[model samples]
Target: MTAGSVEVVLRRAGAPDALAAADVWLRSFAAALPTVVSPRSGDDVRQYFRDVVVPFRETWVADAGGGGGIVGVMVLRDDELSRLHELSQLYLDPDWRGRGIGDRFVRLAKERGPEGLDLWTFQVNKPAHRFYERHGFVAVEYTDGSGNEEREPDVRYVWRP
Candidate 1:
């Protein structure tokens, strides 16, 4: 619930959080991935969060208690056929970085997928690579930017606890 002195309440995301979560996702993406081009517009991302992520995915959000808005979001998805649990999405408000909130999100992902978890990050994002590696994830695969919407080279990382 509380990470250090910060009273952040992490909980399953509800429909009401869709908008705020989308905002955080938008801002975080803009701040963290300035070089990568996104195909979707801001409204498109908002609509996706409202229509799909909140209702369908195993979505979680970090609420900055009191009047503060949702500061973080994480989504987990499972593939029953392959038994793969993917950390589909994780992002935080730019201002909330380095506050240990992202670490909490990673811990939750590991707990939710004790068997293992897989995620992808752009190769250019060294900070993300370090963060994921520090959390026990190892780069297992690399792609040449053709498969993803962003057309950016990515590395797949897997974590086994």
Candidate 2:
């Protein structure tokens, strides 16, 4: 699709979009972290949606629109770190990467008026690190998890608004 032709909308996610959003998340993350973990099955993905995402619809899926279908999804939660918003998940379909959709979602999250924003990324995810940095996020801490649980260090980044 042409640059201006992409019609992306930002809104709260509902029940109907939950499964699809999970699919997007699974596919996106699997592609982005193939070496770290095994690909997620549909059932696992669905459970993840039901458990981690569906229960918290308020701050999740701030943007859920694109050309062919919903190409992006973001999951956020209030941080315990004082007015900080934790961006738990931000996934764009592989085909939709570099289209500014992720950036727009970040902007939308900021527009929602949180005091600060934070997210975690795998150390090997250089592209994602650059993406977060480009959007004004700075590294604050590093730990281990990254869904691998065996290897790879996860770095946390934060942005204050």
Candidate 3:
């Protein structure tokens, strides 16, 4: 999709794209969660996507137009809430982070989601907070570290359109 001045294609991913998508996801996660100890290695993340995420969720990838392989991925879990889709994961290669690709992802969610969308991110991810805020998402809830696997405080943001 044309996100700003760039033309990246966003489409459903099949079995073949899993590995590359997982690598991008993992890299984004590791960089975004540097303080979290025991970050999963790239192999482990790929396995998780192949076994857990792909089997249970909808996966999409962003192609970098020039045949360069995927630079972004998004995993969605629909109906997690009564009327909202849960944005399970959204990651972009560090090289592509500041570009408007992320704004493109947010727009895709708004257009394709049933009614609204929700997502969770670590409370310390202030940059994410700003990004979401700029996209019209509002913080709705906060949770202590106990419930999540990483045991890190988290915030939930919801967007309705």
**In terms of TM-score, which candidate is strongest?**
1
In the predicted model 2, the residue pairs found to clash are none
What are the runs in model 3 whose C-alpha is more than 4 Å off?
1-6, 65-67
Which residue pairs in model 3 clash with each other?
A: 1-8
Question: How close is every model to the real structure, measured as TM-score?
Answer: 0.95, 0.84, 0.89
Better of 1 and 3 by TM-score: 1
lDDT of each: 0.92, 0.75, 0.82
Error of 2 at 85 (Å): 0.8
Measured by lDDT, the strongest candidate is: 1
Compared with the true structure, what per-residue lDDT tens digits does model 3 show for residues 1-161?
Answer: 55465678888877777888898987887788788754466788889888877666788888886645789998877764456888878899887888777888788878778588999989988989999999989999999977788888999999888
lDDT of 2 by residue, 43-78 (tens): 987887877686664434534344456677888777
Ranking by TM-score: 1, 3, 2
- Higher lDDT: candidate 1 or 3? 1
Ranking by lDDT: 1, 3, 2
The TM-score of predicted model 1 comes to 0.95
Better of 1 and 2 by lDDT: 1
Please report, as a residue range, the 10-residue window in candidate 1 with the lowest summed lDDT.
1-10
